[model samples]
Target: LGERVSWQTLATVLIGLLGVLVMLRPGAGLFDWAALLSLGSAFLYGLSQLMARKISDTESSTVMAFYQNGAYLTGALLVAGLFRLAGIEHAVHPSLEFLVRPWIWPALPDLLKMAACGFVASAGMILLSQAYRLAQANRVATFEYTGIIWSPLWGFLFFAEVPHSATVLGATLIIGAGLLAFRTERLRAAPPLLVPTGDTA
Candidate 1:
């Protein structure tokens, strides 16, 4: 906790964030209120990851995953139930409506897909917990940028979506940022050089 942060580490983080901005292709000069929601989510995520690293020493990955998944399920159900009980229906936009819509029994195929997602999510949590446990959080944290690359890759593979120039550039930057972080950390950890100031010992 008392460790000093090096400028190289800050530069790597800034580079990664720049890559994210490049990937997003934000509208020029227009502040979208919806973007704040993403900021809020990011803040919460930071807190979660911080706590994950803090307790990782004593908690098994399995235990952490169980607690996380349990809390997620409980919170989701409670929020949905409250919305349902309030009889609030907003049907203007399909996306908005989806948020407030009453819960319905999903079809068999949809249910199966949802179940599979739950399993995948739990597995992801377990893996995430292990990651924080095994390495310094800062060392592993920048790897999260890879998710941006994965999204476009998956789109191309499954949905026939073509990635644009910005996406390519963004991916390159993100990758370079990670490599820079790795290289910088290695340099810092390397043994100090010994030099002879005098001709005779």
Candidate 2:
């Protein structure tokens, strides 16, 4: 769900939206800078993936998987910490003092929702790792594109946030490209060896 294209593509779209706002407003330097930073990060990630594939032949797949998982976990922790800190700084405690104050811990429902989210997230990670381990890495990674196809559908079904026609079209193109690339890589990685004349009839 997170991997495929949603995580990066969605972030890129949001940053693009911010950039639009910055363009429309005269004094939005900070937003402009932030948007550029986000765009640059996404570009670098794409380049990094290309570089990784170039070097992958030299590294054990298991080691690569470990590093990938470790990076995911580290990113998750950082995001969680950032949100938790935001909540604390906003004095979102639901104690008596908070009740007396204007800031009440967003709400009991929100807190419960966060806990449920965390549980689901942990389970998803476990399942993803298991899935990766059970299949060839390239094959598993190929299927990750399905998440890109499904994300907008999920968003529309759950939040009534209909995706743009352009988004749907773009995702379809990307999925097709991913399939083609996967097939090409698979064939190249395990090309059939030829027999010598002595072995042939």
Among these predictions, the greatest lDDT belongs to 1
lDDT by residue (tens digit), candidate 2, 1-201 = 122443434443444344333333445334444456556865765454444454455754445556655786798678657666566444333231332333357688999998898677666555655555444444445555455557778889999998766666556555654555555546657968997778655
The models' CA-based lDDT, in order, is 0.82, 0.54
The TM-score that candidate 1 achieves is 0.84
Deviation (Å) of 42 in candidate 1: 1.0
lDDT per residue, candidate 1, 38-109, as tens digits? 788789877887788888878999998898888878988897888778877775544346778656888999
Q: Residue 155 CA error for candidate 2 (Å)? A: 1.6
Give the range of the ten consecutive residues with the poorest summed lDDT in model 1: 90-99
* TM-score of each predicted structure versus truth: 0.84, 0.43
